[model samples]
Target chain A: MLPAAALLLVFLTYPLGLGVWLGFTDARIGRPGIFIGIENYEYLWSDAVFWLSVFNTLLYTISASILKFALGLWLALILNQNLPFKSFFRAIVLLPWVVPTVLSAIAFWWIYDSQFSILSWALQQMGLIDHRINFLGDPENARASVIAANVWRGIPFVAITLLAGLQTIPQSLYEAATLDGASRWQLFRYVTLPLLTPIIAITMTFSVLFTFTDFQLIYVLTRGGPVNATHLMATLSFQRGISGGQLGEGAAIAVAMIPFLLAAILFSYFGLQRRKWQQGGGD
Target chain B: MASVAIDEVYKSFGAVEILHGVSVNIEDGEFVTLVGPSGCGKSTLLRMIAGLEKISRGQIAIGERVVNNVAPKERDVAMVFQNYALYPHMTVAENMAFSLMLKGVSKPESDAGVRRAAEILGLVPLLARYPRQLSGGQRQRVAMGRAIVRDPAVFLFDEPLSNLDAKLRVQMRAEIKELHQRLKTTTVYVTHDQIEAMTMADKIVVMHDGIVEQIGPPLELYDRPNNLFVASFIGSPAMNLLRGEIATGGSPSFRGAGGISVPLASALSIPNGEPVVLGIRPEHLRLSDDQGIPVIVAVVEPTGSEVQLIGRTAGGEEIVANFRERHSFTPGETIRLTAEPSLIHLFHGETGQRFQTRTDQ
Candidate 1:
């Protein structure tokens, strides 16, 4: 316990405390600055680009998390079936997740490249497009493109975790439900959905947190490009604190994200609290 | 309620067949038990009857309609699984009502059905509780309640009491039997316990190696087993089998190893020196002082109602004898035991099939 406390104090609490303290000061790249009492946050409040980044972060996290959840749950269900080569397919599904984030982001970067993208080439070859798609050059397309990349990398986590959860449900329940006159759809709606809710809550919480703090995909693909339209708070924080050298402002932006993350955690915490039926004596 | 006719049903998984040409006729409202050892395909047959398993090459009819390709939901049956499979997330009432809900029954109707089943199973207080909250016996009752709520034509029980404790298993066994008596649904139950089959079934189908060895009332199977498997399987403290050949020279007698000879009933006529197996239930053997087969006593167990003596013959064959009147015998003591000629059973040594005698006519 002492060692764990020391590790937390050194690695987590200290860094978070320093960041929160820095957010109140007009700190610079190479020099410690005097405390300025929320000056950075006050400036960020009136800034349009900061508000735009906040909106983009929300949009990106919400859309990407939803997509990841739906597709991941669908994949988990398909993989749970008694298909041939099941383990092989399950292993293959984790490829996107296993690959390094930077590496996969780089791969997505090339896929979204305006001129030489394989997607564009295939579309052109199929006579579906007349010209190259301005994937990153267009603000809407860039946001969608980065979100798509995040979803691809995020799905395997949800799928594998959900698959593990799905396996815990006994096969006899399905047999019992079948004898109880449940149709195929009714079986899933009544049996599968209710049993899967707890896992869904946990998986989606982590997926939301990962998507909300996502930086690598955007940094590699768009770098908050197309007039800062795709700038998430994370990337914007790095841009202002490190690249733009406004350490105070960047720390403030990063600090502002805590409330949202806390909300997500609290939502999942309550969702995970044992339901009345789940609270019981030993089985 | 409806009769279930499993006519020449066979099941195979890829290359290995589990049930080979199995058939059983279940009358409407009759309680039948499929009893066997593990992997005897009794559960497989029960699942096939439930329409959960597809029959490879035969027909199963619930009532008069052949339900070979009918969906399980359309077959109108409810099953209680060995594990109870009571949906862990739902309350007892909800678990019972789930079937009616799937049938699109109205809320009030579904509630009435759940209430009725809960009352029948004595699960009224537990209707609001989850499965994990209930004891093993209670969960078992809830599983039955779920099935009872459906009011289907047939009820399928797949080793429902196997998971309970010994005392609870006996209690649940009686409860399930009583439930069947009250409901009068055509019930097909699967169990590996011969005792459960004996006590609960109207007709017990003894299965061995995926085939029906015998199907009869409990006492009939106990009194006259068709084969060595049934003889050994159907009875508790199983029948003692002594292998020997019939010697027809003087008096028809069984000549076993070590010069031990026991007289056979004169009504039986078989080829001279034909090898056969002799079967006698433990209770049929009586203590004798004079002419009888000599056995060296090994273990003595007294269960208040009866004394079970385990002894070995001079030929080194183990024999079990149950006596209603208690007598003390120490280990290694030689005791003489005998049975009436009419009580002895003879079977072909090679084929394990029982032979009919003149007295059987």
Candidate 2:
């Protein structure tokens, strides 16, 4: 306990207080100014580009989270089936998640290039389009491309966790459902989905939180490019704090993501409690 | 009301066969029990009848319909599992009404069906409660209630009461038997305990090694077993077997290894000097004068109603005697044991098959 407390004070509490304090001052790269309360937050409130960055973060989080859930659940269901070479397939499914995020994001960067991309080359060979597809040129296209990269790297984590959840359900319930005259669809709706709700709640919360504050894939792929169209709060914060050298504003932007994360966690916590109450589960 | 017939059904997994060509004919409203030890394929046979398992060969018919290719949902049979398998998310009413709802039953109609089954099982208060909220015995009743609401043609029970405690098991056993009598559903049950089979089954099929050892009424199997396996398996305290040979001389008698001779009350078709195994139930061995086989009492167990004595005969065969009259014979004391000649059973030594004995009528 002493060691843990000492580590928390030295590493976590001190830095958190310092960052919050820095958000209130006009601290630049080489100079520390007097404490100016609410000045950075006031400027951020009216800045159109700052609001756009918030919008971009919301769009990225919602789209990527929904896609990750749908595809991850599909992969989990397929992995749950009785097939030959099942363990081998499951191990291979986790490759993207196990590899370094920046390394894999580099691969996605090459694939989403405006010219000479393998995807564009394959599409040209199929005659789907006359010109080389500009994957990351337009603002909307860059936003979409970054979200697709995020989903690709995020799917394996969701799939593996949900797969562990699926294996915990007993086979007898399925047999009982089969004998109870439940069709394939009804069996999933009544048995699998309700039983899987808790795990889905947890997995989606983590997915949403990570996508909301994501930095690495966006930094490596777009770098808030195409006129700052896909600059999430995390990337914009990094741009101001480190590259632009406005430490105070960058800390303020980073601090702004807390309320949304709290909302997501509380929503999931209440949803989990409702499930427990409905199932008469233990406290 | 429907009869079930399993005609020479066999099941195999890859290269090893688990159930041999098994057959049984269950009449309408008959409570038949398939009883055996673990790994004897009794549960496998029950699953095959429910269409949960596919038969490798032969046919299973439920009321004239050969359901070999039917799915479990299409077969219209309900099963009570060993673990209950109640859906944890649904209330008791919903768990019971789920099948009817899937059959496109109306809300009021399905509610009425669930209420009727709840009444039959006395689960009215628990209709709004989930499975995890109920006790073991209550959960057991809910599992039966789920099956009852289905109103299927046949009900299958796979060791449904083995999960309960001893007192609860006996109580639930009686409850299941009573439920069968009140509903009169043609039930096929499986259990490893012979007492459950003997007390509850209208007909019992004893299985071992994936094959049917014997099938008969409870008392019939108890009184006249065709082989050594059936003779030993059906009774609570198993029958004692002694290796001996039957003499076909003028005064016919069976002689044991220690040269202890007990005369036969009847004549046998077996030739002289043919090796035979003698079987005698414990209750049949009477306590008499010193004119019978000599033995030393090893232990005495008094169950308030009867004195069960375990003794060793002079030829070194352990014999159990359940005597109605209490005798205060200490251990290492000498005692004489005898049996009425009619109570003795003789089987072929090598074949383990019982031979019929002729008695003067």
Candidate 3:
């Protein structure tokens, strides 16, 4: 017990205490200064660019999470079918998620680039646009592209989670539904969807958290570019502290995410509690 | 409500055949039970009738229409699974109303149907509860209600009472039989429990491996089983089989394993020296001190209502006799037990087929 307590103090408490201290003081990578009293937080509140980054993070997180969930459920259902070589198809479907995110993000960056991009080349060929489309160069398209990338990278996790839930459901339930004259759509609506709600909810919570704090994919793909259209709080924090030399303001901006994170945690708890009451209380 | 006719149907999975060419005529409003041990193709045959599995060959007609290619939803049949596959998400009322809703019945009519079925099953109080909230017996009732509300042409049950406790199984068995009597719907029930078949079935089809061993009324099969399998499978303690060869002379007899001669009915056409197996039910064996084959009493078991005596012949083969009261014999005591000649069954050893007896008395 003594050794475990010492390790926790050395590893967990030390890092958390250091971060909180840095949040208050104007501490940079190579230089440090005395603690500032709420000065950085004041700047964090007044900065329109910082607030825009927050909004972008929420927008990207919500859209990507919902799209991923829907596509994941669809993929799970398809994979669950009694098709030939089902495991092989399921493995192939997991390729996007299994590949390293940074590499896939870089690949997507090339595909969405202004010139010599396959997407632009195809659009030009199709005559949807007569000229090459500069997808990442525009703010709207950049945000959408980033959200799409996140969704692609995250969908397999959701699908695999819900697939496990689906597998636990007895095939007899569907047989009973068939005997009740339920159509294919009715079976999914009344049987599959209700049974999968808990799995989907848990997956959504994790997806929201991961997407909200997303950093690597955005950094590799857009670098929070196109007038900060694709910028998230994580990327903006990095830019403010490491690039703009506003270490105190960046720490304040990073700390500002605490309230939103806490709110998400509370929401997830309440949702799970409600689900518990609806399904059955406790184990 | 409808008759189901299975005509020479066969089913196989990949390279393994599970059901052989089998045929049975199920009359409308008849409660027929397909009974056999596990993996005897009973459930598979039921599923084929329900349009859940395609027949490898042959035809199944429900209510005069060949439903060989009909989808399960279009078959107009309701099935109650062994596990009582009630939807966990829906209330009992919703579960019962689901089939009517699918048929596009108006909400009020469907609700009334659900309520009527629930009331009949004594589940009106549980209509608002989800399946998980109900007990096993209650869930089973809900499953039956779900089927009842549909009022399909036929009710198919795939060992629906197997998951219940012994007491509950007996209770549900009577309930199901009564339900069948009240509804007067054609039903095909599948179970491995012989007691269930004997009690509930208007006709019982006993299957073994992948073939139908016999099909008849419960008493008909019990009193006159066509083959050794049916004889062994139909009874609770199971018929005792003793192997021997046919003996010739003034009084023809069956020579058991230890050269003990047991008299057979003279009407039986048993060739001399041909190997034959003799079958006798336990209840038919009487223990008396009369002139009969000597048996060594090996064990005695007394239930509250009856006593069961386990004995061995001088040749060291075992046989059982169920008595009406506690037996006064010790384990080592030698007793003489008589096998009534009329109750003895003779089967051809090579083919395991029962040889019909011709009596002119």
Q: Write the per-residue lDDT of candidate 1 for residues A1-283, one digit (tens) a residue.
A: 9999999999999999999999999999999989999889999999999999999999999999989999999999999999999999999999999999999999998999998899999999999998999999999899889988999999999999999999988999998888888778888998899999999998999899999999999999989999999999999999999999989999999999999999999999999998787887977
**TM-scores of the candidates, chain A only:** 0.99, 0.96, 0.92
Which residues of candidate 2, in runs, are more than 4 Å off?
A: A274-283, B258-260, B291-293, B314-316, B359-361
Residue B314 C-alpha lDDT in model 3: 76
Docking class of 1: high
Best-first order by TM-score = 1, 2, 3
Quote fnat for model 1. 0.93
- Model 2 achieves a DockQ score of 0.55
On lDDT, the candidate that comes out on top is: 1
TM-score of model 2 (CA atoms): 0.96
Candidates ranked, most accurate by lDDT first: 1, 2, 3
Among all windows of ten consecutive residues in candidate 1 chain A, which has the lowest summed lDDT? A274-283
> How accurate locally is residue A166 in candidate 3, as Cα lDDT from 0 to 100?
91
Model 2 chain B lowest lDDT segment of ten? B352-361
> Going through the candidates in order, what is the number of backbone clashes in each?
0, 0, 0
RMSD of 3: 2.3
Candidate 2 lDDT over residue span B91-110, tens digit each: 88999999998899999999
Candidate 2 global Cα RMSD: 2.1
**TM-score, chain B only, every model?**
0.98, 0.96, 0.97
Candidate 3: give the clashing pairs.
none
